[model samples]
Target: MVSLVCTLRSHQDDVNCCAFSGALLATCSADKSICVYSARDFSELPFSPLSGHGYGVHYCCFSACGQYLASCSTDATTVVWSMDTGEIEAVLEHPGRSPVRVCAFSPDSSFLVSGGSDGTIALWDFTSRTLLRTGAVTDTSIVACSFTPCAQLFITGSTYGDLRLWDLNMNHLHAEKNAHDLGVSCCQFAPQIMKGTDGCVQFRLASCGQDSLVKIWIVSLLSAAGIKMQLAHTLTGQSAPILSCAYSADGQMLVSGSVDKTVTVYQANEGVLLYTLNQHDRYVTACAFSPTAPLIATGSMDKTVNIWMLEDGSGAQGKSLPDEAASVLSSGGRKSSGHSRLMVSEWSEEDVLAWLREEGLEAVIDMFKSNNIDGEELLSLTKETLSSELHIESLGLRCKVMKKIEELKMAPVSNGTPDEYLCPITREIMKDPVIAADGYSYEREAIESWINTKSRTSPMTNLPLQTTLLTPNRTLKMAILRWTTCQ
Candidate 1:
């Protein structure tokens, strides 16, 4: 229920901010940089950290699909990164005297929102980083904002106890409310459409303020019509100012970190405390839970990133704790860089054939040679013979067959033997034969048998000899049988 799973110490100064998606966690520091770690192994993943900010980093958050991350700095810039390749997608800068404090991604990942010290909010297109809208605050600086689950609207909170809802499609202010009596430190969009399991389709917003109060609000159509949403509950356990708050994916758990140097996990529907984590020596600045994992990662002013997990979750009960020193992937094996097993199953027959073609004729030759045959000579002979027959342009296939016979006659054989042999007419082996002898100098029977195996059983005339023989006395005779109609 309460344990430090892993600790990352790459940052040199106070690591005051962190963010987690389904599989990754990123932390920001007063060292003016950020480091992202993998949720699977707790080791560093490949990411190019952006560090051109003049001041220290403050906060970071990932998009829904885990493809994009937004990090804000006191240097007045918010940098967007491509999470998959760890490349900077865009750099957002404000024209006024505002230092960017925190940033968040739209649920659909099409836009980004940032809060600045000048009490203004800026919206940037996800791809172009071009400003879409800018809204000025009334009294205090806006510190945080979150988009609804559908990304149609967003809510921004200021230090002067103000919360404003902006309609993204209309590019105008939708609603405003006094969420707290003091500075609102952080705010988040609840995963549910309503606070309770009712038919109401609304969004709940969780905010922590300088009053040490954690408040929840319902942003439904009923509430937008000037009817205030009922405050579901308020958690009052933390003695210091609450700095961060987030809801679990299932909306069953709520986690909050504070200047009180402690982070508390609470039941979402009920305000009862489920667990309390107290590992930080200094104030805990931010905390986040991986949506698909049982992990919880936090950054503290003590200059370290701590990861924890629930006791009953898989890999937390009986599994070994992750060693921070281990590699990101399993060691000493071929890592599959692309397609998985399920991907291969979905490939079509055409895809398989195309893959084979990419292997080329060289692979085919290798396969043929594996059977102890000269595949190169066989292919070359076939090509040349086909070309010659086609060049002659014969109508019947007889000429091509004759050409094949000549090729077989001229082909060099092994053991220095001549290609054409004088076969024995009566036996399977060669021997010395007399002039009138029915025997031959070679195995005519075997050759005739081999040639007959390839015959089509067509009517015979003065057909080409399937085999030929020569006697010991040098008499030569074609093995062809002359079939004639005797009348």
Candidate 2:
């Protein structure tokens, strides 16, 4: 289980991204600033709210040793900050004044790689504060880039939905492919490797895009064809475009954020959804799992950052029992000396219907009713009969059932009227609310439109706007959710 532990409210505008360096949490925003906070208590650091970028900071990352911090911005520059002193050590810029969108530090922390809107990728030796090399991976802007564990190879994802593999020297393209239907927004390598047959190590690459799908690829360092790559699996569940993805330090879990306003955790090897965190009311733009703890940090367009704590023993916790054993439990049957018999024959149709309703299995009940099957029939039906007669394939049905079960298990059941939750402007339950400069809350879209086109003033106060930034009112939102749950 994953539960929201704290919400950080410092960014005046949308929180664009977040990262973790040991016990420190860093977040960047459209306010052209970055803030550092304590991951343990969500307290703002003394030297936080670092402001130097001329434009919105798009991404931020920490070096392997957590000694240095790097942030890329639309100001066409990347700033390297000394974490200890909170001082700028170096500022690297693109030659064409193109907006820098993504950056990564090499595993050894000796070099940094950055990609920008001009389709250029630059490598800089941080120790010397000098650009080592520059090249273009595509004519379109590059949106995502990351170095492999070995630091000899890195991958870049482009706005054109192309994925390219590059050598460390940035002189060779090992392979390239059209990986997604829309812009490839994020990519990361698995933190662990699988040993191949010939003693070579095989790694997995995960990429998400505007296509609302996550694709996994197998990359082998030593193949007969030389650095072979193949599609491993495709995960589909998010309703909107995915913005970011990251693998846990142990590589047993994968976490993804989407514009669908949810963060999903998946079992790395099996590609199964373990949890769906839905506390954010707007697009979840960035997510990162802590390298040393069972914690996750997420930033959203809602203008808030949330830290989630995964329960102990819950990471990548797969099915509890084998397939045969699960079947036996569901049937309420006990194994004899050498045989098994149905033990639930005494359950009546009404009793079974009540149980199903209690368990939120209305869909299954409807299916049974459509087939004119009763409680006794369902209890006695064999697995083969249930599948064949209901025309239900195991894979698809199993996924749906598992997802529903997990959701029900984690969600707090609620029943309440909508009047108290209605937005002041929309007069309906607010899906995403923002606090304007007038000290009043309104739906984000309604307030943005009021400020942009109508007038440069507060709709509620009719006063000239002090600032255009809208801060998220997460406190009220949480209160409304809790009120509904207790009703």
Candidate 3:
């Protein structure tokens, strides 16, 4: 069960998209404007109502670091905005003059990709304010685009009811398949790899269409024939077209918004319906989950956005059978636990490895290096030896070590490589990089703040700037994006 925490009413027209960036939330609408609000209180920001689009804003997304926001419109332009100032940093226009329907930022925040109604896909270096490439994706409009977790691949959904996978280079089509009977409206990659039957590992993608069905795909890049995608599951319950779908950060659950004025939640792995939320008065347009919180934000054609908190089972008001009776019911009255018992009893090293990989803990060996322990040494040490050296009881030390391992499992990997594409002030990779008059490029927001609040002088050098205007560093931005793709 879930409960609505807040209902925001600011957009006069339909709210098309909603995205969360830590404590901040951004929403765009058919009112031809974008609004930013504090997620903590749902208060509109002082510098919000960013209005520059010539037509209705169709979609908006925050950069991975939340420093920049990108929105596409029916006017055939995609504008990148600095979240710090709520000002446009760059404007990207497709060469074909097609209305951009969807846009997405790569995981590294180095590239912005937009798909348009003309079936053209445009890749832009937002930091440089330059278009990197434009290619045709389909004969019909593209409605959604999403990058894989690794940022190496992207998938696009089209009005032709097809889903296509493309390489990050924007030069090759990896795979193409007819995905739905009606136009595909939304698509998203699962935040984590999924384990399927037969000990197979797969990258999962969820897509919803006007056909009123949501389909989950299993993509295998290691196939003998190269990248391949197959339908894994079809979730059929929505009576109207689904407008959006999203996976929770940990990939345990999936959520979808539909034209039926309802939102649905499902168990991601099993496709089990968990709950249905019918709080909106009109069609639900977009749905997203906070990356670090058990919160969901849904936008609707009713011109409102609602925030909901995912509840635990303790809050569920349902009766359940006793353990023995429940077990019998689940097992069809069998005395033994049957195949489920065999699966648990026969867990193997392969299964353990699979679980670790799925949990993003495959780099545990690297994580242990901070403690001056090598993989070899750790493997050689016995429980007694470890306990004696640490001066603790064997069981206590084992428990503590297990807890420490769990903590380290979520620690970020130290690649030790400095990102040259980062802003000098914020120390984050630049999402809207711009070059000032002093021949140094900084993040758009960082430089704008320096010029507007601190001083008109260049931050890099103490020289006074003759003009506060900045130029887009298109070449370096494109170079950085290409470099990131290779990485």
Candidate 4:
């Protein structure tokens, strides 16, 4: 049940890659240009068809914030463009001066790496737009590269049929010599990390190859013997070489394009093929999933990019987060439930608990949890039900709880808390705000998780931390407490 919503026709030559951020979709092609389009309606941006590359553009990717885009080209350089002005931010020449084949940004948008045909990899300090370091892989061309969710190690795939893992200092950690017989075409690490029993860390990565196979592997860190990679699944849906593969934002689904002129979507964990799309007339070169929408984009040698909507059991269209955010923007800062905000009726059980804890209503937390009360349940609560059902004998307590609920209903859904009240590490409002050495405040748990991952860098600056010490931000905490009380 895959249906093509629209076909983009901006590229005059073969489209090499297509990437989507939360709000924008960008496509690179052999036409020596890149086009930017609105993810909402597929309308071209006014500054699109960016033509700065001297040679053909091969790949493009967006930063985590969707504020910038990086594109690699046969011109032996990677160009970073600002999404705000659609202007070039910086041009990084490949170290070996070899034609740059691929590029990837760290999850935190602190670092950018470009892979070159000469097996040279250049890492850039994204904050300063300067080269941090360079390293070489096998003699063969470096074609694919991606960073793990931790942002500590990265995997590179080369035409030599090896996938090598390396740390930030360009130190070789591990290598899989037989990753693909003919050579790896593309590789991507899943966005989400899973914790296993006994404090083990797990990551999943999917790679497509010229051997006409898509392989998924389990990457384990903190293993007794060091890092480990185990083959998890091998999928064979395309008859010809699989060129590109990508995981959906949630990492539940995978999609790949192939020389067979088709795109295959799979249930990643189960290795089950969900759909085989055949809209492209020529070889399918690239494929990507929208991070904020139930949509997939595929590019082909036919010089077109096709957008497909992922429908659920029902045929109703699910709105993209960017579209909702755009609505909020158009309405003059009414704001959308992008991250810092959630509608009263849309809060999860945990969100409700967070609210209760912030409002000093912890005595009723156990009761609310036991009853499985959620956002929807909270809205329907009345003073009568509170006293009779929950057996709240204190009239003042019931009135206070009801007052908080009333404030929730009357206030604009997006008007939850000030952005400063939220931790930079996690978008949610901070319960325990602590000042880090980087001079930024973050939630205790979030910053601790960031440090435990050994990223050991400021999530805000992407620079090395001078100290791991976290000081309590009592003043800010008190201010948040006062604001909540007023609300």
Candidate 5:
């Protein structure tokens, strides 16, 4: 059973949005203020009521690190506020001076996208705090946006009843017009990346609209086959327009808030309604699932935010943490923070930050975040680069940073290697690769870490693994050695 843990009435006006990071929760409202609360006891932080917006705040989102909060307003700007000090870090103006309706940080936190009332979308380089590009759809306000887990693409849903996909370069990859009958109020991609039996990368996206329906779409990306998004299922649990939808950290469950003052939770993949919560006294405007817990926060026009805890044994605790923290978890995690799902050459700026924190090099986290150091940039980091580009004053820290980068480069498939030689868990060329019970070969350290933390299950199939024993993939290792020598 879902139990209400607490109700926050800090906002004198309607609560427009609520977001949670690993340790904190933030809610914004028409009161033109943002409230910060510690997830532990639901107490407002001393520095809360962050008040930089000139007009009613419409939305607020936390960065992946939980260090910063971004909020947009009717005043035509999106402000990034430091959670540590409750101070405004940057004020990004929308391109057309139009009221900004929503803003979202990319999965890696390297980019920020803000959609405005005038149908304009501005993409910003978060590190540099500069506008990279802008796009728009005529006659429609962009109301919702979400980045895919891979960080390579994003989807924006608008009042035109369309969902448009775009790449980092702001190129329109695809568009699904009439995705919703009336208009889309919210859209979010599931955190997990699934691989089908056919080898195509599959991503699930949940979208809700004014039509009182929630949709699950399967987006498939193939190297040569192009991109295809197919409607997988539709949920009609809500009786009125759903305003917000969110996927649980595991991507197994979905929760949405509606105009009918109800929150419906569903089994995402199977499209089964799991629970219907009616604690809100007015139209529910926002909903979010905690990234590190089985808790959910739903906000309503009643000017309150209700926190609900998923009771133990509800299967909510079985899932691993979100993708960013999965590898760093003690069990069912990577061997070290140096390890990640993407190849070292493909790591994003936030990936670098996570590794730094895991490696106890938090001193340089800000330095790396400021420079937007991604996987390729990570591979290229050197003592000289750290000192020169990153301005690290301490020689020891520079040396440590360089050493970690080198370790990252040597950890997995560094670059210029065939994908076949890579471990599915760590995406690194396996030096001591072993075949698991699922007939998949993974690096010894990587697979062991995963098995220790997660249940004895196949990473690819999510099926029960017959055994923990992993046989050495000597032939594949030999092939990798040969390929390395040739390189």
Candidate 6:
């Protein structure tokens, strides 16, 4: 199996936010500087370090085309930079005691949005760098905000656990209320799917605070004044407080990184936990789904950044690797027959259906695929269609299903590795602790699979492992690690 790949040593201080423009990665750091690095290689050094924020740069993002970059900071300022010239185009300064907590460019690239500590959201014209609109609700700081794909709507999450929607055209408040039990951390609008179909506008937002839970909200309400949106559904539960979340370009998958030192993927609407990325050595500060690829890039307090891909049922063997690293992705442990059955039932939806479809029974499988059909033959179908276009979702699903099938069809419910069980790497026991792209080691591929398995299938990956720092004087050690690895 190939292991996940990570480009180390990209930032100096904590990397608060990350965005991509083509092959370039724009990162904001607490060191009060923003660096643009070649996404292709970190060893090459930054293209340039644009410095200006008086304090730590809080957040940074790229324009749709990636030609421009935007960064906001505790300095109460947001600066715009042109990647081509490596120069600052605009400096946004607002009056108030609050820091410019968050800033974002509208999808259209015509405007930018910034929310501050005083609970105010400002919309600005990029060309004029002038404030166009403002929405003030709670007195608490507005922590997260995003403009919908269409650019007419904006949503903000606050320290009070409430979320508010604003109307850009009307300059009015549209919707407001608590989105979770605690302060909200991040909010994101789903990409527009189906070229022309605007069914129900859905936005997936994640909120966290003292509460370790990460709640997902689907908004459908629209403001009568001009904005349109409605609250639909929410999903909760994370090993730690979630700090950030992003949806892949396709919108079929969402990646969330948390203070919990792990990253988890959730099905947008169903709120199913597809995988638990237990790899970071410290709290994950930021995560961004690649705009055009299957990669999920994560930054953490551990002073490292990792790039991971969602795998189908294939196993750890597909992970990029060395012989010593080959076994990490395929690692597994004592089999829990009952749990295995549940996991296959839950995480195997995409796999099961694809198998049935290949067998000419596509329309007959239930949503869960739990019917008592001939299990062995059905699994073979998964292997057959894994590489074909008819199969959907990420390739990770196929890999997962294929593994479970091998276990179910060949062995009894014992801890012993089945006769067909072969490490995708060494083709041996997923022994000697497999390390994931995120940096932590897994007991076995099955263990990682179980933890990362779709919640609908495996539910839980075995009581969750305790995450502790690998170094003494963790924070200082991380700073040094970041500098060394990145340089």
lDDT of 2 by residue, 13-67 (tens): 5688898988788999876789987766666665677878966798999998888
Residues 1-487, candidate 5: write the lDDT tens digits. 5766666755656789999999999999876789998887776676777878866688999988988899998767999999899999999988867768899998899999999866789999999889999998777788899999998889999987999999988899889999999899999999999997799999999999999999999999978877899999999988999999999999988999999988888889998887787767789999999999888999998778888777656544223223232122121111333334456666778777887765557898898898998878887777888888899999977876775565454433334457678776555567998999999999999889767745565666544689999899999999999987865
- Which candidate, 2 or 5, would have the higher lDDT against the true structure? 5
Better of 1 and 6 by lDDT: 1
Model 5 misplaced stretches (Cα beyond 4 Å): 314-487
What candidate 4 gets wrong by more than 4 Å, as runs, is: 314-487
Q: Candidate 3 lDDT, tens digit per residue, 1-487?
A: 5766666655656789998888788999876779898777666676767889866788999999999999998767999899888888888886676667899998888888999876889888767878887778655888899988777788989988888888867866564556877789999999776554644556889999999998988887763556778877899858899999999988878889999988888887777777777777789999999887888889997777877777687333222212222121111111211221222223344433333333233444233333445333443445565566534454743554454333233211112113457565444456678888888888888788767743465544444678888888877678767755654
RMSD to the true structure for each prediction, in A, is 33.1, 19.3, 21.6, 21.0, 25.2, 19.9
Higher-scoring candidate on TM-score, 1 or 2: 2
lDDT at 192 for candidate 6?
57
**In model 6, which regions exceed 4 Å deviation?**
42-46, 169-173, 193-210, 221-233, 312-487
Scored by lDDT, model 1 comes in at 0.62
Error of 4 at 433 (Å): 67
Q: Model 3, 140: alpha-carbon shift in Å?
A: 0.2
- TM-score-superior candidate, 1 or 3: 3
lDDT of 3 at 95: 63
Q: Give the distance in Å from residue 118's predicted Cα in candidate 1 to where it truly belongs.
A: 0.6
lDDT of 4 by residue, 1-487 (tens): 4556777765656799999999999999876789999998787676777879966787999999999999998767899999999899999988856678899999999999999876889989999999999999755788899999999889999887889999999998889988998899999999999876767898999998989999999988876777888999999988999999999999999999999988888888988888877767789999999999888999998777888777776322222123222121111111112322666677888888877765558888887887778888999999998888877788978887887787576443145567688665444567899999999998999888767653476665544689999999999999988987775
> What residue runs in model 2 are displaced by over 4 Å at the alpha carbon?
313-487
Tell me the tens digit of each residue's lDDT in model 1 across 152-252: 78888887777777877535455455667777888898876654354456787788888888887776655335334567788886889888888878777
Q: How much RMSD separates candidate 4 from the native structure?
A: 21.0
lDDT of 1 at 212: 87
Point out the worst 10-residue segment of candidate 5 by lDDT.
325-334
